[model samples]
Target: MSAPEIYEDGCPICKERLENGSDVVQIRQKGADGINAASVQRGDNVDVAAGCKAWLNEKFAPDLLETKQDVVDNMMLHLQNMDENLHKGHVGEPKSTIHQLELERLRFVLTSYLRSRLRKIEAYFPHLLDQQRNQTAEDPLRLSPDEYIFAEEYANNMSLYFRRVALRHMPTAQQKLDLSKTVAPPDLDAFVFLQVKDRQERVLIEEATDDQEEYVIDLEENSKHLMRYKPIAPLVSNGAVQLI
Candidate 1:
């Protein structure tokens, strides 16, 4: 069965209780079979919305984006609260079933989002690690703390495996993993479908063919386009456009 519809009304489960002076927003869930609306806290709804957007961005971006640690953490907290509440309700109840379905859906989105980043890290660990090493204190971190550890361990293990399986047998001069020559970085020139969130002026589009001259175009707000990722990379990171 489909999950219940969540609206921005107030949450039914957590009432309007503020924690640590945090604003308490409410959400209304419309049951699948036209049952009455149920309330839920506003925090859960906001975090879930952010989590879904982050998921889509991670899925579409060629390079790994900054980790949305706060969004993930908040969503996880909400999921835990929902799970505890569900456990208190009887099985076979329509409300419980709806809650269960919605919980599963959120889990899937969060799982898929994390898995996408892990796959990218696995594919470009060496390059990603190098980037991490070179980043200054002011730069935003590309990997979360856990992910950074995973990438480091994965890089070390791969290096060891290569040495044991083949590198040791090579000539001493050749027994090295040259990351610059061995690792393939993500292709920023790849084309992506995106929707513009804000109007952008004089966005440059480099010519693919040598014979063609480069040109610039304006990206109107709310318009969709297929374009190469490189020139618009900053726009995506700054939330001006959403990759489809």
Candidate 2:
């Protein structure tokens, strides 16, 4: 038996007004597929895009595998202990609030990592995946043989993202620009105030230009101050500070 069809006229993509009522086709579903919560909040300071770029570059240089993996693993495992402590006596996999929070923390680390690589894929091959490319393949940067196809495919999938990033070409300036173009890198250039969620020591001063200064700022609980958004990206990424 065929079920009765219900018709609702509107744009399917965004649910706004339809440009042409007769041209659009609407599909009717049997059941609702909505969730109570759809998105997860990761910290602001954690620069996954930066992490991604580092990982990709390291991949090309096989000798640094051990050193790179250690740094990456340490960052991801930072929250796993708390996650385990929160689920100490469970026989089955725990689905408690603490477990969810821990999962989110790990997710943030991975999300940032992947995002950073995509940023590189964009810069290194700015026009490779474009539908209407302004630059040629030889004009832009080239990825290694192992990375070329993957970077192109990944960049294609994240096309819309390239549009939203505020400063796309800035990061590639560090590289030889005869070929490199920064694609949709996450911007960490903003200067702003932040409030410390907990007591933190040795926070890098936002205004310091020299990395060799041995300068570190301490923040007491609930303390607020001006800082560069990038220096505190790790803190924000891990939920240590609140934007003010």
Best by lDDT: 1
lDDT of each: 0.76, 0.46
lDDT of 1 by residue, 51-164 (tens): 777898889989988888887887688678779988998887655665687778778988999999999999898888888999999887899999999999998898899899
For each candidate in turn, the TM-score is 0.80, 0.29
RMSD of each candidate relative to the true structure: 6.7, 19.8
Question: Considering summed lDDT, which 10 consecutive residues are worst modelled in model 2?
Answer: 30-39
Q: What TM-score number comes out for model 1?
A: 0.80
Per-residue lDDT for 167-200 in model 2, tens only?
A: 3655665423322244443345656667788789
Candidate number with greatest TM-score: 1
The residue-level lDDT of candidate 1 at 99 comes to 69
